[model samples]
Structure formats: C-alpha cells, structure tokens
Target: MKVNVKYFGAIAESAGKSEEVLDLEKGSSVKDLKNQQIKKYQIQDADSIQIAVNQDLKNEVELKDGDEVAFLPPFAGG
Candidate 1:
C-alpha cells in the first residue's frame, strides 16, 4: 500500500519536503507508518511528534491505500 504524507513546521524541514508518497506494507498501522517515516528521515524522538490520518488525528489506525497522513511537530507559543 502507498500513502501520502504531509509534514509541517520542523517536521517538514527535517523531511526536506512538504509532502511525499510512502510505500508501506498492506495492513500497516499508523504507528508502523510513523516508524517508517522516522527511519526514512533519520529523525530522533519520533514519539514526540503528532500524526494525522486523512486530516484527522489518529494513532494505531490501519492505513488504507492512498490515505493522506500528516506529521506535525509540537507547537510552542504563548
């Protein structure tokens, strides 16, 4: 299965792109995708990042072919 991924803020910078297509195994979960992304980007502390699937925040959800995923770094503002 293949999924579209979007990155925001620092995550995007780290990924070197605002969006990308990720090829994953069928029946992969959101966590699986996140792990793959972290490895692909050589990211550290991936657990701190937030993830959204098809524009909705989710974790452990099964990914479908062509699903859109987003990775966002923690926002710090007052």
Candidate 2:
C-alpha cells in the first residue's frame, strides 16, 4: 500500500522534506509507520511526535492506500 506523508516543524527538518509518498506493507498501522520513519530519519524525541491520519489525530490505525498522514511536532500554545 502507498500512503502520502507530510512532515511539519522539526519533523520536516529532520526528514529533510515537507512531504513524500511511502510504500508500506499492507495492514500497516500508524505506529508501524511512525517506527519506520523515526528510525529511517533518526528523529529524536520519539514520544513528542504526533500523527494524524486523513486529517484526524490517530493513536493506532490501519492505514489505507492513498491515505494522508501527517507527522506533527510539539506546538506551543499562545
């Protein structure tokens, strides 16, 4: 399955891009993608990253082909 991934803030800096498409194993969960990407990018502060699937924040989700995933860094409230 292929999914579109978007990175923001520090996540984009770490990933070296703002977005890309990823080919993942079928039935891969959000956590799986997180783990794969974090390791691939050697991103620090793993626990600080948040994921949203198809524009909805998700903890654990079965990703579908063409789904959009966003990796968001910590945000400060003003």
Candidate 3:
C-alpha cells in the first residue's frame, strides 16, 4: 500500500523534505510509520511529535492506501 506522508516545521527540516509518498505494508498502523520515519530521519524530540491521519489527530490507527499522514512538531505560543 502507498500513503502520503507530510512533515511540518522541525520534522520537515529533520527529514529534509516536506512530503513524500511511501510504500508501506498493508495494514500498517500510524505508529508503525511514525517509528520508521523517526529512525529513518533521526528526528529528535520524538515524544513531542504528533501524528494526523486524513487531517485528524491520532496516536495510532490502521493506515489505508492513499491515506495522508502528517507529522507535526510541538506547538509554541507567547
């Protein structure tokens, strides 16, 4: 299965890309992808990262082909 993976802020910088299409195993969970990416890109602050599936925030969810997943860094405010 193929899915679109998006990176934001520090995550994008770490990955050296804003987005990419990945060929993942069928039935892979969101957490599985997150773990793969974290190790692949050596992304820091893993504990602060958040995952979103099809625009909805999620910690873990079964991924589907063509689904869009975004890795969001922790937010900051004044």
Candidate 4:
C-alpha cells in the first residue's frame, strides 16, 4: 500500500520536505509507518512526534492505500 505523508514544523525541516509518498507493505499500522519513516529519515525521538491520518489525529490507526499521513513536531507558540 502507498500513503501520502505531510510534515509540519520541525518535522518538515528534519525531513527536508513538506510532503512525500510512502510505499508500505500490506497490513501496516500507523505506528509501523512512523517507525519506517524515522529509520528512513534518521529522526530522533520518534515517540515524541505527533501524527494525523487524513487530517484527523490518530494513535494506532491502520493505514490504507491513498491515506494521507501528517507528522508534526511539538509546537512552541506563545
């Protein structure tokens, strides 16, 4: 399955892009995808990241083809 990923804030800077397409194996969960991304991007502290699927926040959602995943770093706004 292939999914679209969007990066925000520090996540985007670390990834060096705002969006990307990820090719994942069948039955891959959101957590699995996140792990793969962390490995691919050499992201540190993957557990502290925030994620959304198709614009909705998710914790343990399963991914499907054409799903949009967003990775966001911790926000610090005053």
Q: Rank candidates, TM-score, best first.
A: 3, 2, 4, 1
- Position 3, candidate 3: lDDT: 97
Local distance difference test, candidate 1: 0.85
Off by over 4 Å in 4: none
- The TM-score that candidate 2 achieves is 0.93
Q: Number of clashes in model 3?
A: 0
Q: What is the TM-score of each candidate against the true structure?
A: 0.85, 0.93, 0.93, 0.85
Off by over 4 Å in 2: none
What does the lDDT come to for candidate 2?
0.92
lDDT of 1 at 62: 89
TM-score of 1: 0.85
User: After superposition on all CA atoms, what RMSD does each candidate show versus the true structure?
Assistant: 1.6, 1.1, 1.2, 1.5
Clash total of candidate 4: 0
Residue pair clashes in candidate 4:
none
**Model 3 C-alpha lDDT per residue in residues 14-77, reported as the tens digit of each score:** 9999999999999999989999999999999999998999999954669999999999999875
Between prediction 2 and prediction 4, the one with superior lDDT is 2
What tens digits encode model 1's per-residue C-alpha lDDT throughout 1-78? 889999988888888899988788899999887887889888766878989888888556789999999997887879
Clashes of each: 0, 0, 0, 0
Query: Cα miss at 56, model 3 (Å)?
Result: 0.6
